[model samples]
Target: MRQPQQERSRTTRRRLVDAAVECLAERGWNGTTVAVIAERAGVSRGAAQHHFPTREDLVAAAVEYLGEEQISELRARAAALPDGPSRAEPVAEMLLDLYTGPMFRAALHLWVAASTDENLRAVLVPLEARVGREAHRVAVELLGADEARPGVRETVQATLDLARGLGLANLLTDDTRRRRQITRQWARILEPAVATRTVRESA
Candidate 1:
């Protein structure tokens, strides 16, 4: 009885979090009300309230849940890439895919909302920091970037920043062509740095 109850609780919470993400993506912060999220989740208002006592609490939990899901998906995608000298482009492409998708859009909505809402900022800042750190770790590991080498860490960070900027552009304009051009160009630059580090370490 206890086990089943716990499982059901988890299911309900998951549905609520997922519904919150969808709400955030479809409607901006002001539009994503607790009642709306409950409707989308197919749960009663009381149940939503029981799960999340306040709007801030619910949105914070939703962001954390989405961040975890994104990180897990990132790791899985990274693990699927073929290991070789030619892995950099595919890794970079995978990173771009992660940055340009629905989860990123949901996060962008939160970022814009948090700019004016102190409560939201208080919840988002630390969560964003954690997600950024984990993303950097995954990128460096999957791309076999040698941070011990001079400027390698900075290069990897810059690549991520560049990708994010491109993704932001994608939100407003059709930057797909430019994004591809820039990604390929950066991949060319990054591959050499990775190769130099490998040779130096092997020598």
Candidate 2:
């Protein structure tokens, strides 16, 4: 039936995208290719090309697809956060977890490639911008950050930037022990920095 054929087609496309992301994370952009991804996905080269005519197209789709998956995971985790005065530490840890993962690794590879390839940049710039905006919005919700408060927006953005730096550090070596310590300290600092005070004060 048409329904079964459509479902199978969707499955194959998902496999290709997932394989592309995994390949990007493992083997930098120079190493990832349509043939390799097709092999990893257990699909034929022609099938992969049928879905994504070019390597750039495949990688672009992979980044957008996984970015959404990560965002959805972030939102789901935010809903389950424990209610208490000390939620910042957990939130900080969770946010850091976002950057130090396979998706981030894959995206980093794409970033490096895009830096030199105008064609890749043309495809990636807008995708990353949209992902960045969604990430910022979700971070505000998770941190209970009041953007109206002075420095609060910067504080929230700083947390994400720190997480990214930590993720970059992790790409070279194991930075877990130190990363945990840093995020813990940042959480303590962030709790007050992003606090929404009722009484207005002069800046």
Candidate 3:
């Protein structure tokens, strides 16, 4: 059981993580450090060390923070729309939302740092798989795909591939119409897989 001190420690750790996220957003991964995060969180260096023994561990946690943040936002967007077809709407609209803003950029920056860290890669890779798999699962359920179907792997892979490629394109370019075009195109491609019922319900 966590005592009062331990509970406080946990709170402090959360603050540190939040602060580290801000620092990463503000300074990028190379500029973010234990001392900087501790200062940002209003906790001492010792408290920071107590939570994260190394800067690498801290960076790893920041990547996790980014993933959780993105997933939560995506899921919220998922829930706000209708149940079925509306499900496809979020998928249809992902490019616009994902490519915009500081939060995602910060997360991407941390990801680049985490990708190069072998120790962090172990944790990070699974997180990537989970997000991808979860999105694919959503697509499958919405599409009304019969799991026993032989072509299921190819179907799911298509959604993942288009989403990844379209997202990168959206990020690189400033053309909003082009971004919308890609999403709509992907949505059309996704229609057979997730199903019009899900899209209809969502719409």
Candidate 4:
């Protein structure tokens, strides 16, 4: 039996997306090109171009693909969170882990590149906004945050901002111990702020 042409094309596209992310993470934007991604994907440059005519097209597709994957994983992790007072620490850790992964590194490269390139920024800005909104929504759910309460929403957003900052710090060096310590402290501070009782009782 042989695979259908549609399935084959899908596989090729998946490979190209994966390879593009890997290239971005490993080589940054300058070193990542259509030809490099094509070679890494094990497809001809012509085939790669056939699927994504421009580098921006491929990068946009990859960001969109990675964003969905991150959101799906976030939902799964949120479901598995333990039911107890200790949940905040794990929730903090989970959200921080989101930014420390390969996808974030790949996205960071694009962010720096997009800072200077108007065309790339045009392609990336909307995609990044969508991803950021989804991330914030999931963080709210995971934290059991009651946005109806004052400051609760900002607290959740701060956690995400902290995670992103830590992720950027990790790009230059391994600061795992310090990062973990900071998240633990933030979790302590965060738990009381977002806890259901605190939200209801706070005046």
Q: Evaluated with TM-score, which candidate comes out highest?
A: 2
> What is the Cα-based TM-score of model 2?
0.92
Please list the residue runs of candidate 2 whose C-alpha ends up more than 4 Å from where it truly belongs after superposition: 195-203
- Give the distance in Å from residue 4's predicted Cα in candidate 1 to where it truly belongs: 1.4
Q: RMSD in Å for candidate 3, one decimal?
A: 3.9
TM-score of every candidate relative to the true structure: 0.90, 0.92, 0.72, 0.91
lDDT-best of 3 and 4: 4
> Of models 1 and 2, which has the larger TM-score?
2
Query: Local distance difference test, per candidate?
Result: 0.81, 0.87, 0.66, 0.88
- Backbone clash tally for model 2? 0
Task: State the lDDT of candidate 1 residue by residue for 22-55, as single tens digits.
Answer: 8988897888888999999999999999999977
lDDT of 4 by residue, 69-131 (tens): 888988897798665456788888888877887889999999999999999999999998988
Model 4 score (lDDT): 0.88
What's the count of clashing pairs in each model shown? 0, 0, 11, 0
lDDT per residue for candidate 3 within 57-118, as digits (tens), equals 77667656655666666666566655554455466676334535555556666667777867
Model 3 segments beyond 4 Å from truth?
1-7, 83-87, 99-103, 114-123, 138-147, 150-153, 170-175, 196-203
- State residue 87's C-alpha deviation in candidate 1, in Å: 0.2
Instruction: Tell me the alpha-carbon RMSD of every candidate.
Output: 2.2, 3.5, 3.9, 3.1
